[model samples]
Target: MTERQHTDQALIARIDPAALLERTRSWSAINSGTHNLHGLTHMAALLADAFAVLPGELSLVDGDAAESVGADGAITRLEHGRHLRLVVRPDAPVQMLFTGHMDTVYPVDHPFQTLAWRDANTLNGPGVADMKGGLSVLLEALRIIEAAGTPSLGYEVLINSDEETGSFSSARLIAEAACGKCAALTYEPALADGTLAGARGGTGNFSVVVRGRAAHAGRNPQDGRNAIVAASDVALRLFEARSPALAVNPARIDGGGPNNVVPDTAVLRVNFRPGDTGEIERARTLIGATTRAVAERHDVSVEVHGGFNRPPKPIDAGAARLFALVKDAGSAMSLDVAWRDTGGVCDGNNIAAAGVPVVDTMGVRGGAIHSTDEYLLVDSLAERAALSALTMSRIAEGALS
Candidate 1:
């Protein structure tokens, strides 16, 4: 056998599937929802302890405060859980970034809070596939590489607490860690059939708050401007802005009052997805024009909060090279690694915005993410870990130019 084949066999043998599953189960049991501070703190501590086995400087970095417009048309500060960062061999020539999130879409009060085996090889639960399993895979891969002796590559591992809701708090930190890296890998679950995400569309969220004079419904009603009507108009105009390259979703409007009173406030929550950089600019322009026109037509004051946090990630030359490297590594292990464009956005978009090429779905093979039906293909734990280990080793050996 060739030297590379022998090395691959040794690394694959060291990954224990049972251990990886157990770690995922234990982490999934905790309700580390994006807004569950207590749960997030507890989960963060456990992750730090688990990742401490690696050779690096590990620290829980405080999260930045995020602002959200409330139902009452008030902007409030939101506190997020701390992010875990580990840097090893910072001075090494070939540096890379690996990131995953600890948060799941299931809130603390959500009913999907436990795990069960759907079958002999399928385990289902919240966050199990969407990322606790991915975390386990990442750690196991790193462990195998370390056991092989000192690695020639340097990498930074970032496990942040806010991703399901958007990586606002950890975005700056992600960009900072991505600086000067040769490539990046993010552990968002891959499709059950092992399909990865290729070029991804960008996403933006906005809350448009409208203010008007309040008046009694039975008397002087004409003296007051209807904020709810104005907000609804804004939503419709924004929805009409959708095109082949841009998708607009006006999700919720939070305002209205009892009869006999004209409601004076309304907040519209909307999301936008742009297919490319030009589309992103068009989306912004649409928002500005729509809000201004609505305000003028309805005679009400309008305020827009939020912008596109994730920029569109088109496959550049660097990203294409990284994907080719991953495909070659998967082929060596008899795995067919393929990808297609997805409308879903993740930290991958943010990292790519920093000019770093990233293969984001380097995690367990799973499906039904963002829902209670999420399941992880139990066998993929070791399978994907070995794939990652081999890929990183190839890069360390100067396989990519």
Candidate 2:
């Protein structure tokens, strides 16, 4: 083997699968759900301790308070957990960003809180695949890279606490870190078969509040403006706005009172996935037009909250080069790396929107994320870590220019 191949093998050999699995198990045991403040605090502390092994300045950043429209049509502040940030060699010529999340979809009250061995090769549990395992792999890869003493590349690590809930609290932080970076890597978990997500569509979440005059249904039904009816009409109109480029889902509606009284308040919660910028514009136009017509016809006041936080991530030349570099690294390790377009959106979308080339799924191979059946391929712990280490090493060597 050539000297370079020998050096790569030596770095890969330092990755210990058993230690990675142990870390994943311990991290997943904590209930760091998006809304679980206490759990997230605990998880953040643990992460800070684990990531302290790296050579950098680490800090716990307080997230901005997020806003939410309540069922009573009142806007309220939603608190999120603190995020972990680590910066190393910031003055270096080549800088990169590495990001992951500590929060899972499963809340503290969720029953699937324990981990189990599906077999000798698979492990299942909360946040195992969708991304506690990914976080472990990321830390190991960075540790290996640091051990190799590559002085050409500097990187910043951002582990936010609110990614599963649209990253509202940490969006600005992500944008700041992504600025002026040559590339980014996000550990959102690859598919079970080791395939990564390519060009991802953008996502928006909206809450529409409808207010109407309430009156006794039996005594003055005609005099009362029905807010429930108006809300339903808005939902239908938004649903019809769905097209080939945009997917609209009106997830839920909250409002209504006793059967004897006309409802005075209703809130519609909807999500929109736009394939491109044009579709995002179309979605906004549809929302404005539909809400205006519904309000006029029902004599109600309409309010819209929320917006398209994640922009669509297309495969630009820079992104294509990053993917090719990753694929080549995987091939060097006798692994086949492939990606396909997906509708799912993550912090990667926000990072790519900042004009940074990012290959976001540099995590473990797993399936059934955001569900109770989520599992991680046990062997991928070392495999993916090695892949990321080699990829970063190549970037340090100026292979991505």
Candidate 3:
């Protein structure tokens, strides 16, 4: 191994994996799904309490007025309940931020809310792999950074109560906090095989509502426009628009009644993903044109809702540098660290879109996210925490660019 690789590996080996495992296990026991406001509050309070023990200032940033940027570039604040932010040494100008969400996709009464040990090195539970485990890693990483030595690189930790629901109510707040930061680390879990996600496709959800005249099927069928048929045609057109890099999926169709009546209203819920902005705009144009054409043909009024929620997170120079730092840190622990671009979207997309450089997959390694089988590798807790600590250390020492 090269001299730098050897030294990094030595530093990584010094981190205690056992302590990380215990902490993750304890945290995995909590249930904090998106709609579970009470659970999220409890988790936020727990995080606030945990960070309170650290030698830094902790303040809870209100995420209530977070704005949602629409497809047409219009912004509106969405009410998403409540959120929290804890800053350690917030006044430092050169700041590094760590972000994670306490809310999981599961609801409060989900059957998978409990955690159990699959083996000596694996723990299974709701949200364990999706993010609660990552939260533990963040806390431990902070502890290690403090133990290593205090450097003047300022840092803040933002733990939101709503992320599993697409950050509808916290995006603006996240953007505000992330602005002006030199770099960011988000605790989204790495792939089960330990691969990081380097780039992510742009994501958006859309709904087309069609209004038509309803009539009795037997008496005045010709008088009705049959909005359901128009919506079906639209759905098929959307599905046929898929290409190698872009896909359109008609997720759901609503508003159908008795068979004896011509349906007057229909709703089509669709989702699309494009590799970049150009493709996103192209897809949007196509969708808009198609919807208009279909509505005109059926003589029905059409309304569209939901648009690009987050922009694509492309690989920028800042992200590349962060990856190199993380790779070097992983090598110190005898691990091979690499990442690939994915079509999946996350809060990382929002932060990157806000022009902040981010290293997103700084959480535990695991698989089966958003499923009952969600599990996190116990070893990655310490491994990732150590990597984060070292990265923060290097940033403080000015060894990282």
Point out the higher-scoring one by lDDT: 2 or 3. Answer: 2
Instruction: List TM-score per model, in order.
Output: 0.98, 0.99, 0.90
Q: lDDT tens digits, residues 119-158, model 1?
A: 9999999999989999999999998888887567899999
Candidate 2 residue lDDT tens string, 303-368: 999999999999999999999999998998999999999999999999999999999999999999
Quote the positional error of residue 390 for candidate 2 in Å. Answer: 0.5
Error of 2 at 13 (Å): 1.2
CA lDDT, every model vs. true structure: 0.93, 0.94, 0.79
Model 1 residue 294 distance off true place after TM-score fit, in angstroms: 1.4
Ordered by lDDT, highest first, the candidates read 2, 1, 3
- The TM-score obtained by model 1 is 0.98
Model 1, poorest ten-residue lDDT window? 144-153
Candidate 1 residue pairs in backbone clash: none
Task: Return the candidate ranking by TM-score, descending.
Answer: 2, 1, 3
Query: Which tens-of-lDDT digit does each residue in 328-352 have in candidate 3?
Result: 7676667789999888888899889
